[model samples]
Target: MEIKFNDVNYKTKLTDINITLNNSKINGVYNYNSFLKVLLNPKLIEKGNITIDGKVYNKYDPKVIAVIDKDMPFYTSKVIDEILFYSKIRGYKNNNIKEDINNLLEKFNLDSNILKRIGHSLSETEKYYIKLIANLIYKPKIIIFKDIMSGMDYKNKKIIKKLMEELKEQGVLIILTSSNSNILYELTDEVVIFNKGKVLINGSTNDIYSNIEILLNNNIDVPYFSLLTYKANNEKGAHLFYRKDVRDVIKDVYKSVS
Candidate 1:
Protein backbone atom coordinates (compact mmCIF):
# COMPACT_ATOMS: atom_id res chain seq x y z
CA MET A 1 0.00 0.00 0.00
CA GLU A 2 1.71 3.11 -1.28
CA ILE A 3 0.23 6.61 -1.70
CA LYS A 4 1.82 9.08 -4.03
CA PHE A 5 1.10 12.67 -4.91
CA ASN A 6 2.27 13.40 -8.43
CA ASP A 7 2.47 17.13 -9.01
CA VAL A 8 -0.72 17.56 -6.97
CA ASN A 9 -1.92 21.13 -6.60
CA TYR A 10 -4.51 22.67 -4.34
CA LYS A 11 -6.22 26.09 -4.27
CA THR A 12 -3.24 28.26 -5.20
CA LYS A 13 -2.03 27.44 -1.69
CA LEU A 14 0.26 24.49 -2.44
CA THR A 15 2.14 24.40 -5.69
CA ASP A 16 2.94 21.19 -7.59
CA ILE A 17 4.01 18.64 -4.97
CA ASN A 18 5.37 15.13 -5.46
CA ILE A 19 5.59 12.56 -2.67
CA THR A 20 5.75 8.76 -2.55
CA LEU A 21 5.03 6.97 0.72
CA ASN A 22 5.21 3.18 0.98
CA ASN A 23 3.53 0.50 3.11
CA SER A 24 4.39 -0.55 6.69
CA LYS A 25 6.17 2.77 7.19
CA ILE A 26 5.58 5.90 9.22
CA ASN A 27 6.17 9.27 7.57
CA GLY A 28 5.75 12.75 8.95
CA VAL A 29 4.31 15.72 7.07
CA TYR A 30 5.31 18.77 9.04
CA ASN A 31 2.91 21.37 7.67
CA TYR A 32 0.02 23.58 8.72
CA ASN A 33 -3.61 24.33 7.66
CA SER A 34 -3.82 24.81 3.91
CA PHE A 35 -1.74 21.71 3.25
CA LEU A 36 -3.72 19.51 5.68
CA LYS A 37 -7.14 20.60 4.34
CA VAL A 38 -6.02 19.66 0.86
CA LEU A 39 -4.50 16.32 1.87
CA LEU A 40 -7.28 14.82 4.06
CA ASN A 41 -10.34 16.38 2.43
CA PRO A 42 -10.37 14.88 -1.08
CA LYS A 43 -13.07 17.42 -2.10
CA LEU A 44 -10.33 20.09 -2.04
CA ILE A 45 -7.75 17.93 -3.87
CA GLU A 46 -7.48 19.32 -7.39
CA LYS A 47 -5.38 20.38 -10.38
CA GLY A 48 -3.25 17.23 -10.17
CA ASN A 49 -3.29 13.52 -9.53
CA ILE A 50 -3.24 11.64 -6.24
CA THR A 51 -2.61 7.97 -6.68
CA ILE A 52 -2.75 4.94 -4.44
CA ASP A 53 -0.55 2.07 -5.70
CA GLY A 54 0.34 3.94 -8.95
CA LYS A 55 -3.20 4.24 -10.30
CA VAL A 56 -5.20 7.43 -10.84
CA TYR A 57 -8.40 7.64 -8.80
CA ASN A 58 -11.74 9.19 -9.75
CA LYS A 59 -12.64 9.01 -6.06
CA TYR A 60 -10.31 8.23 -3.19
CA ASP A 61 -11.68 5.52 -0.92
CA PRO A 62 -12.40 6.74 2.59
CA LYS A 63 -11.87 3.22 3.93
CA VAL A 64 -8.47 3.05 2.28
CA ILE A 65 -7.30 6.36 3.69
CA ALA A 66 -8.21 7.42 7.22
CA VAL A 67 -7.14 10.75 8.66
CA ILE A 68 -7.63 11.12 12.41
CA ASP A 69 -7.40 14.87 12.53
CA LYS A 70 -7.53 16.33 16.05
CA ASP A 71 -10.11 18.90 15.04
CA MET A 72 -12.42 16.44 13.26
CA PRO A 73 -15.93 16.30 14.76
CA PHE A 74 -17.40 13.43 16.75
CA TYR A 75 -21.21 13.25 16.79
CA THR A 76 -21.86 10.72 19.59
CA SER A 77 -22.03 11.84 23.21
CA LYS A 78 -20.82 8.58 24.76
CA VAL A 79 -17.44 7.14 23.80
CA ILE A 80 -18.75 3.60 23.40
CA ASP A 81 -21.56 4.78 21.11
CA GLU A 82 -19.12 6.74 18.98
CA ILE A 83 -16.63 3.88 18.62
CA LEU A 84 -19.28 1.21 17.93
CA PHE A 85 -21.10 3.32 15.32
CA TYR A 86 -17.97 4.16 13.30
CA SER A 87 -16.49 0.69 13.68
CA LYS A 88 -19.62 -0.90 12.19
CA ILE A 89 -19.67 1.64 9.37
CA ARG A 90 -16.02 0.78 8.67
CA GLY A 91 -16.88 -2.96 8.41
CA TYR A 92 -16.70 -4.21 12.00
CA LYS A 93 -20.28 -5.55 12.05
CA ASN A 94 -19.84 -8.33 14.57
CA ASN A 95 -22.41 -8.80 17.36
CA ASN A 96 -19.71 -8.76 20.05
CA ILE A 97 -19.04 -5.01 19.92
CA LYS A 98 -18.90 -4.48 23.68
CA GLU A 99 -16.40 -7.29 24.18
CA ASP A 100 -14.39 -6.12 21.16
CA ILE A 101 -14.41 -2.52 22.39
CA ASN A 102 -13.34 -3.56 25.86
CA ASN A 103 -10.41 -5.48 24.39
CA LEU A 104 -9.41 -2.45 22.36
CA LEU A 105 -9.66 -0.19 25.41
CA GLU A 106 -7.49 -2.59 27.39
CA LYS A 107 -4.99 -2.78 24.51
CA PHE A 108 -4.49 0.97 24.78
CA ASN A 109 -4.42 0.87 28.61
CA LEU A 110 -7.58 2.96 28.71
CA ASP A 111 -9.92 2.51 31.67
CA SER A 112 -13.42 1.00 31.33
CA ASN A 113 -15.01 4.31 32.49
CA ILE A 114 -14.06 5.75 29.10
CA LEU A 115 -17.14 4.00 27.72
CA LYS A 116 -19.36 5.77 30.23
CA ARG A 117 -17.99 9.28 29.69
CA ILE A 118 -18.88 11.91 27.10
CA GLY A 119 -16.30 12.93 24.49
CA HIS A 120 -15.59 16.26 26.21
CA SER A 121 -15.17 14.57 29.57
CA LEU A 122 -12.01 12.72 28.53
CA SER A 123 -8.56 14.30 28.62
CA GLU A 124 -6.56 15.01 25.46
CA THR A 125 -4.54 11.79 25.84
CA GLU A 126 -7.70 9.76 26.45
CA LYS A 127 -9.28 11.29 23.37
CA TYR A 128 -6.21 10.47 21.28
CA TYR A 129 -6.15 6.79 22.31
CA ILE A 130 -9.92 6.32 21.92
CA LYS A 131 -9.85 7.94 18.50
CA LEU A 132 -6.92 5.71 17.57
CA ILE A 133 -8.92 2.62 18.60
CA ALA A 134 -11.93 3.85 16.63
CA ASN A 135 -9.82 4.27 13.49
CA LEU A 136 -7.80 1.07 13.97
CA ILE A 137 -10.95 -1.07 14.24
CA TYR A 138 -11.75 0.18 10.72
CA LYS A 139 -8.59 -1.64 9.54
CA PRO A 140 -7.60 1.27 7.35
CA LYS A 141 -4.79 0.66 4.89
CA ILE A 142 -3.36 4.08 5.67
CA ILE A 143 -3.80 5.98 8.94
CA ILE A 144 -2.98 9.64 9.38
CA PHE A 145 -2.55 10.93 12.93
CA LYS A 146 -2.58 14.71 13.04
CA ASP A 147 -0.50 16.41 15.72
CA ILE A 148 -0.88 13.40 17.97
CA MET A 149 2.35 13.84 19.89
CA SER A 150 2.41 17.56 20.50
CA GLY A 151 2.08 18.51 24.22
CA MET A 152 2.30 14.84 25.31
CA ASP A 153 4.68 14.09 28.17
CA TYR A 154 7.79 11.99 27.45
CA LYS A 155 6.36 8.90 29.20
CA ASN A 156 3.06 9.09 27.35
CA LYS A 157 4.91 9.77 24.12
CA LYS A 158 6.75 6.47 24.62
CA ILE A 159 3.39 4.67 24.81
CA ILE A 160 2.23 6.43 21.63
CA LYS A 161 5.45 5.42 19.88
CA LYS A 162 4.87 1.79 20.90
CA LEU A 163 1.35 1.91 19.43
CA MET A 164 2.78 3.38 16.23
CA GLU A 165 5.33 0.55 16.15
CA GLU A 166 2.47 -1.91 16.36
CA LEU A 167 0.78 -0.19 13.41
CA LYS A 168 4.02 -0.37 11.39
CA GLU A 169 4.32 -4.07 12.18
CA GLN A 170 0.80 -4.58 10.83
CA GLY A 171 2.02 -3.24 7.44
CA VAL A 172 -0.09 -0.10 7.64
CA LEU A 173 0.84 3.08 5.83
CA ILE A 174 1.11 5.54 8.71
CA ILE A 175 1.39 9.30 8.36
CA LEU A 176 1.90 11.53 11.36
CA THR A 177 1.48 15.29 11.14
CA SER A 178 3.31 17.51 13.57
CA SER A 179 5.18 20.79 13.60
CA ASN A 180 7.22 19.31 16.41
CA SER A 181 10.54 17.98 15.09
CA ASN A 182 11.43 16.19 18.32
CA ILE A 183 8.54 13.76 17.98
CA LEU A 184 9.06 13.37 14.23
CA TYR A 185 12.69 12.29 14.60
CA GLU A 186 11.85 9.41 16.93
CA LEU A 187 8.41 8.49 15.62
CA THR A 188 8.75 8.54 11.83
CA ASP A 189 10.82 6.56 9.36
CA GLU A 190 10.94 9.52 6.99
CA VAL A 191 9.94 13.16 7.26
CA VAL A 192 8.84 15.82 4.80
CA ILE A 193 9.47 19.16 6.42
CA PHE A 194 7.56 22.09 4.97
CA ASN A 195 8.68 25.66 4.73
CA LYS A 196 6.10 28.31 3.84
CA GLY A 197 3.82 25.56 2.38
CA LYS A 198 6.49 23.99 0.18
CA VAL A 199 8.76 21.02 0.68
CA LEU A 200 12.01 21.98 2.38
CA ILE A 201 13.33 18.44 2.76
CA ASN A 202 11.93 14.92 2.53
CA GLY A 203 14.27 12.13 3.50
CA SER A 204 15.07 9.41 6.02
CA THR A 205 15.20 10.46 9.65
CA ASN A 206 19.00 10.06 9.77
CA ASP A 207 19.55 12.20 6.69
CA ILE A 208 17.05 14.80 7.88
CA TYR A 209 18.60 15.04 11.35
CA SER A 210 22.19 15.03 10.07
CA ASN A 211 21.60 18.34 8.32
CA ILE A 212 21.03 20.51 11.38
CA GLU A 213 21.71 23.67 9.39
CA ILE A 214 18.65 23.18 7.15
CA LEU A 215 16.37 22.59 10.14
CA LEU A 216 17.75 25.68 11.91
CA ASN A 217 17.25 27.77 8.77
CA ASN A 218 13.62 26.64 8.60
CA ASN A 219 13.17 27.59 12.31
CA ILE A 220 12.48 23.97 13.28
CA ASP A 221 13.85 22.96 16.62
CA VAL A 222 16.26 20.05 16.75
CA PRO A 223 15.53 17.38 19.35
CA TYR A 224 16.98 18.25 22.76
CA PHE A 225 18.96 14.98 22.84
CA SER A 226 20.55 15.89 19.48
CA LEU A 227 21.41 19.35 20.79
CA LEU A 228 23.10 18.00 23.90
CA THR A 229 25.03 15.43 21.87
CA TYR A 230 26.10 18.07 19.33
CA LYS A 231 27.26 20.43 22.06
CA ALA A 232 29.20 17.64 23.77
CA ASN A 233 30.81 16.61 20.50
CA ASN A 234 31.69 20.19 19.62
CA GLU A 235 32.90 21.49 22.97
CA LYS A 236 34.21 18.44 24.82
CA GLY A 237 35.35 16.62 21.65
CA ALA A 238 32.85 13.89 22.50
CA HIS A 239 30.92 11.88 19.93
CA LEU A 240 27.38 10.74 20.60
CA PHE A 241 24.33 10.16 18.41
CA TYR A 242 20.88 10.82 19.80
CA ARG A 243 19.11 7.60 20.83
CA LYS A 244 15.56 6.92 22.04
CA ASP A 245 16.59 7.36 25.64
CA VAL A 246 18.77 10.03 27.24
CA ARG A 247 20.59 7.47 29.40
CA ASP A 248 21.97 5.75 26.28
CA VAL A 249 23.13 9.12 25.00
CA ILE A 250 24.83 9.79 28.31
CA LYS A 251 26.59 6.42 28.17
CA ASP A 252 27.90 7.27 24.71
CA VAL A 253 29.16 10.59 26.03
CA TYR A 254 30.94 8.88 28.93
CA LYS A 255 32.53 6.29 26.59
CA SER A 256 33.71 9.09 24.33
CA VAL A 257 35.25 11.05 27.22
CA SER A 258 36.79 7.95 28.87
Candidate 2:
Protein backbone atom coordinates (compact mmCIF):
# COMPACT_ATOMS: atom_id res chain seq x y z
CA MET A 1 0.00 0.00 0.00
CA GLU A 2 1.34 3.40 -1.00
CA ILE A 3 0.03 6.87 -0.24
CA LYS A 4 1.52 9.58 -2.41
CA PHE A 5 1.26 13.29 -1.70
CA ASN A 6 1.90 15.04 -5.05
CA ASP A 7 2.69 18.73 -4.91
CA VAL A 8 0.19 19.21 -2.09
CA ASN A 9 -0.27 22.85 -1.14
CA TYR A 10 -2.63 23.94 1.58
CA LYS A 11 -3.37 27.63 1.89
CA THR A 12 0.15 28.65 2.95
CA LYS A 13 0.37 26.28 5.94
CA LEU A 14 1.76 23.50 3.71
CA THR A 15 3.67 24.02 0.46
CA ASP A 16 4.72 21.86 -2.44
CA ILE A 17 4.65 18.65 -0.43
CA ASN A 18 5.73 15.63 -2.41
CA ILE A 19 6.43 12.47 -0.51
CA THR A 20 5.69 8.84 -1.28
CA LEU A 21 5.27 6.29 1.50
CA ASN A 22 5.27 2.69 0.17
CA ASN A 23 6.94 0.59 2.83
CA SER A 24 5.09 -1.24 5.59
CA LYS A 25 7.49 -0.13 8.33
CA ILE A 26 6.93 2.19 11.28
CA ASN A 27 7.43 5.73 9.90
CA GLY A 28 7.82 8.75 12.17
CA VAL A 29 6.66 12.10 10.78
CA TYR A 30 8.13 14.89 12.88
CA ASN A 31 6.26 18.16 13.67
CA TYR A 32 3.95 18.51 10.67
CA ASN A 33 0.40 18.71 11.94
CA SER A 34 -0.83 20.70 8.97
CA PHE A 35 0.54 18.09 6.56
CA LEU A 36 -1.19 15.37 8.58
CA LYS A 37 -4.47 17.21 8.25
CA VAL A 38 -3.99 17.27 4.48
CA LEU A 39 -3.09 13.58 4.32
CA LEU A 40 -6.13 12.52 6.36
CA ASN A 41 -8.48 14.78 4.46
CA PRO A 42 -7.36 15.47 0.91
CA LYS A 43 -10.20 17.91 0.46
CA LEU A 44 -8.08 20.39 2.40
CA ILE A 45 -5.36 20.25 -0.23
CA GLU A 46 -6.15 23.19 -2.49
CA LYS A 47 -3.53 22.60 -5.15
CA GLY A 48 -2.65 18.90 -5.43
CA ASN A 49 -3.62 15.30 -5.02
CA ILE A 50 -3.30 12.46 -2.49
CA THR A 51 -3.50 9.02 -4.06
CA ILE A 52 -3.74 5.53 -2.61
CA ASP A 53 -2.22 2.82 -4.78
CA GLY A 54 -2.21 5.21 -7.75
CA LYS A 55 -5.87 6.04 -7.32
CA VAL A 56 -7.63 9.04 -5.82
CA TYR A 57 -7.83 9.00 -2.02
CA ASN A 58 -11.08 8.95 -0.08
CA LYS A 59 -12.12 8.82 3.57
CA TYR A 60 -13.89 5.48 3.05
CA ASP A 61 -10.69 3.75 1.89
CA PRO A 62 -10.94 0.34 3.51
CA LYS A 63 -7.21 -0.21 3.96
CA VAL A 64 -6.60 3.02 5.91
CA ILE A 65 -7.26 3.47 9.63
CA ALA A 66 -6.35 6.19 12.10
CA VAL A 67 -6.24 6.31 15.91
CA ILE A 68 -5.96 10.00 16.55
CA ASP A 69 -5.37 11.91 19.82
CA LYS A 70 -8.96 13.16 20.01
CA ASP A 71 -10.57 9.76 20.05
CA MET A 72 -13.96 9.07 18.54
CA PRO A 73 -16.90 9.19 20.96
CA PHE A 74 -18.35 5.81 21.83
CA TYR A 75 -21.61 5.17 20.05
CA THR A 76 -22.89 2.71 22.67
CA SER A 77 -22.93 2.96 26.44
CA LYS A 78 -21.12 -0.29 27.23
CA VAL A 79 -17.51 -0.78 26.08
CA ILE A 80 -18.33 -4.26 24.80
CA ASP A 81 -21.20 -2.90 22.75
CA GLU A 82 -18.98 -0.27 21.18
CA ILE A 83 -16.39 -2.82 20.16
CA LEU A 84 -19.07 -5.11 18.75
CA PHE A 85 -20.52 -2.22 16.74
CA TYR A 86 -17.15 -1.40 15.18
CA SER A 87 -16.45 -5.05 14.41
CA LYS A 88 -19.80 -5.41 12.72
CA ILE A 89 -19.33 -2.27 10.59
CA ARG A 90 -15.78 -3.12 9.58
CA GLY A 91 -16.87 -6.61 8.49
CA TYR A 92 -14.65 -8.45 10.92
CA LYS A 93 -14.39 -12.01 9.57
CA ASN A 94 -13.58 -13.73 12.84
CA ASN A 95 -16.28 -16.16 13.93
CA ASN A 96 -15.65 -15.73 17.66
CA ILE A 97 -15.30 -11.99 18.09
CA LYS A 98 -15.77 -12.12 21.85
CA GLU A 99 -12.79 -14.46 22.15
CA ASP A 100 -10.75 -12.22 19.90
CA ILE A 101 -11.69 -9.17 21.95
CA ASN A 102 -10.62 -10.98 25.12
CA ASN A 103 -7.27 -11.85 23.52
CA LEU A 104 -6.76 -8.20 22.60
CA LEU A 105 -7.70 -7.21 26.15
CA GLU A 106 -5.10 -9.57 27.52
CA LYS A 107 -2.43 -8.13 25.21
CA PHE A 108 -3.35 -4.59 26.21
CA ASN A 109 -3.41 -5.53 29.94
CA LEU A 110 -7.09 -4.69 30.30
CA ASP A 111 -9.30 -6.92 32.42
CA SER A 112 -12.35 -8.65 30.92
CA ASN A 113 -14.61 -6.92 33.46
CA ILE A 114 -13.76 -3.55 31.96
CA LEU A 115 -15.72 -4.47 28.85
CA LYS A 116 -18.96 -4.38 30.82
CA ARG A 117 -18.31 -0.88 32.11
CA ILE A 118 -19.80 2.27 30.60
CA GLY A 119 -17.69 3.59 27.75
CA HIS A 120 -18.06 7.25 28.62
CA SER A 121 -16.90 6.52 32.16
CA LEU A 122 -13.58 5.01 31.11
CA SER A 123 -10.39 7.01 31.70
CA GLU A 124 -8.75 8.85 28.79
CA THR A 125 -6.05 6.23 28.49
CA GLU A 126 -8.56 3.40 28.60
CA LYS A 127 -10.58 5.10 25.90
CA TYR A 128 -7.52 5.33 23.68
CA TYR A 129 -6.83 1.64 24.18
CA ILE A 130 -10.39 0.74 23.29
CA LYS A 131 -10.21 2.83 20.15
CA LEU A 132 -7.00 1.07 19.12
CA ILE A 133 -8.63 -2.32 19.67
CA ALA A 134 -11.60 -1.31 17.57
CA ASN A 135 -9.33 -0.35 14.68
CA LEU A 136 -7.04 -3.37 14.97
CA ILE A 137 -9.90 -5.86 14.73
CA TYR A 138 -10.02 -5.63 10.93
CA LYS A 139 -6.26 -5.40 10.39
CA PRO A 140 -5.86 -2.27 8.29
CA LYS A 141 -3.10 -2.05 5.71
CA ILE A 142 -2.20 1.47 6.78
CA ILE A 143 -2.56 2.92 10.28
CA ILE A 144 -1.81 6.48 11.35
CA PHE A 145 -1.23 7.51 14.95
CA LYS A 146 -1.12 11.27 15.42
CA ASP A 147 0.01 13.21 18.48
CA ILE A 148 -0.91 10.46 20.95
CA MET A 149 2.27 9.25 22.65
CA SER A 150 3.25 12.22 24.81
CA GLY A 151 0.86 11.22 27.59
CA MET A 152 1.50 7.45 27.66
CA ASP A 153 3.47 5.98 30.55
CA TYR A 154 6.46 3.70 30.05
CA LYS A 155 4.45 0.47 30.33
CA ASN A 156 1.88 1.64 27.80
CA LYS A 157 4.60 2.69 25.37
CA LYS A 158 6.30 -0.69 25.74
CA ILE A 159 3.05 -2.52 24.96
CA ILE A 160 2.48 -0.27 21.94
CA LYS A 161 6.01 -0.82 20.68
CA LYS A 162 5.61 -4.58 20.80
CA LEU A 163 2.24 -4.38 19.11
CA MET A 164 3.66 -2.18 16.36
CA GLU A 165 6.50 -4.63 15.74
CA GLU A 166 3.97 -7.45 15.40
CA LEU A 167 1.90 -5.36 13.00
CA LYS A 168 4.94 -4.52 10.91
CA GLU A 169 5.72 -8.21 10.55
CA GLN A 170 2.16 -8.68 9.27
CA GLY A 171 2.77 -6.04 6.52
CA VAL A 172 0.93 -3.14 8.13
CA LEU A 173 2.09 0.36 7.29
CA ILE A 174 2.36 2.38 10.49
CA ILE A 175 2.78 6.15 10.55
CA LEU A 176 3.48 7.73 13.94
CA THR A 177 3.49 11.46 14.59
CA SER A 178 4.86 12.73 17.89
CA SER A 179 6.42 15.87 19.35
CA ASN A 180 8.89 13.73 21.34
CA SER A 181 12.05 13.11 19.33
CA ASN A 182 13.13 10.44 21.83
CA ILE A 183 9.94 8.49 21.33
CA LEU A 184 10.35 8.62 17.56
CA TYR A 185 13.94 7.47 17.80
CA GLU A 186 12.88 4.56 20.01
CA LEU A 187 9.97 3.38 17.83
CA THR A 188 10.33 4.39 14.18
CA ASP A 189 12.34 2.57 11.48
CA GLU A 190 12.15 5.54 9.09
CA VAL A 191 11.92 9.25 9.95
CA VAL A 192 10.57 12.11 7.87
CA ILE A 193 11.63 15.46 9.31
CA PHE A 194 9.43 18.44 8.44
CA ASN A 195 9.99 22.11 9.19
CA LYS A 196 7.59 25.02 8.57
CA GLY A 197 5.26 22.84 6.47
CA LYS A 198 7.98 21.51 4.15
CA VAL A 199 9.92 18.28 3.87
CA LEU A 200 13.28 19.10 5.44
CA ILE A 201 14.62 15.57 5.07
CA ASN A 202 13.37 11.99 5.08
CA GLY A 203 15.43 8.81 5.38
CA SER A 204 16.33 5.88 7.60
CA THR A 205 15.99 6.83 11.28
CA ASN A 206 19.61 5.96 12.08
CA ASP A 207 21.07 7.90 9.16
CA ILE A 208 18.82 10.92 9.73
CA TYR A 209 19.69 11.17 13.42
CA SER A 210 23.39 10.47 12.83
CA ASN A 211 23.64 13.70 10.85
CA ILE A 212 23.51 15.85 13.99
CA GLU A 213 24.91 18.94 12.28
CA ILE A 214 22.01 19.19 9.80
CA LEU A 215 19.39 18.79 12.53
CA LEU A 216 21.09 21.35 14.81
CA ASN A 217 21.39 23.82 11.93
CA ASN A 218 17.66 23.55 11.21
CA ASN A 219 16.74 23.98 14.91
CA ILE A 220 15.24 20.50 14.90
CA ASP A 221 15.43 18.53 18.13
CA VAL A 222 17.78 15.55 18.18
CA PRO A 223 17.28 12.57 20.46
CA TYR A 224 18.89 13.17 23.86
CA PHE A 225 21.21 10.16 23.69
CA SER A 226 22.38 11.04 20.16
CA LEU A 227 23.20 14.59 21.20
CA LEU A 228 25.06 13.33 24.25
CA THR A 229 27.12 10.94 22.15
CA TYR A 230 27.95 13.70 19.68
CA LYS A 231 29.00 16.11 22.42
CA ALA A 232 31.19 13.50 24.10
CA ASN A 233 32.97 12.69 20.82
CA ASN A 234 33.51 16.33 19.85
CA GLU A 235 34.28 18.03 23.18
CA LYS A 236 35.84 15.31 25.35
CA GLY A 237 37.71 13.50 22.53
CA ALA A 238 35.94 10.31 23.64
CA HIS A 239 34.88 7.65 21.13
CA LEU A 240 31.32 6.66 22.01
CA PHE A 241 28.63 5.12 19.85
CA TYR A 242 25.06 6.34 19.51
CA ARG A 243 22.48 4.36 21.49
CA LYS A 244 18.78 4.60 22.05
CA ASP A 245 18.82 3.72 25.75
CA VAL A 246 20.42 6.08 28.25
CA ARG A 247 21.75 3.18 30.34
CA ASP A 248 23.60 1.83 27.30
CA VAL A 249 25.05 5.28 26.67
CA ILE A 250 26.17 5.50 30.32
CA LYS A 251 27.93 2.11 30.08
CA ASP A 252 29.68 3.10 26.86
CA VAL A 253 30.79 6.43 28.38
CA TYR A 254 32.17 4.60 31.39
CA LYS A 255 34.15 2.26 29.15
CA SER A 256 35.55 5.24 27.21
CA VAL A 257 36.59 7.04 30.42
CA SER A 258 38.18 3.98 31.98
User: What is the C-alpha lDDT profile of model 2 across 120-180, one tens digit per residue?
Assistant: 8899889988888877876778888877677789999899899989988887778888878
For candidate 1, write residues 1-258 as lDDT tens digits: 887877877766677888888865788878756656765665676777777788875464667878786666666888888787777676767677678678778877788988889998888778877777777777788888888866778777878788788888888888888877778888888988777657778988867776677777778778777777767777777767766577797788778877
Q: lDDT of model 1 at residue 228?
A: 78
Question: For model 2, what is the C-alpha lDDT against the true structure?
Answer: 0.82
Cα lDDT of all candidates, in order? 0.77, 0.82
User: What lDDT would candidate 1 get against the real structure?
Assistant: 0.77
- Model 1 is weakest, by summed lDDT over 10 consecutive residues, at 33-42
What TM-scores do the predictions have? Answer: 0.84, 0.89
Q: Which parts of model 1 have CA positions greater than 4 angstroms off?
A: 58-61, 88-92, 229-244, 252-258
RMSD of 1: 2.8
Worst 10 residues of 2 by lDDT: 61-70
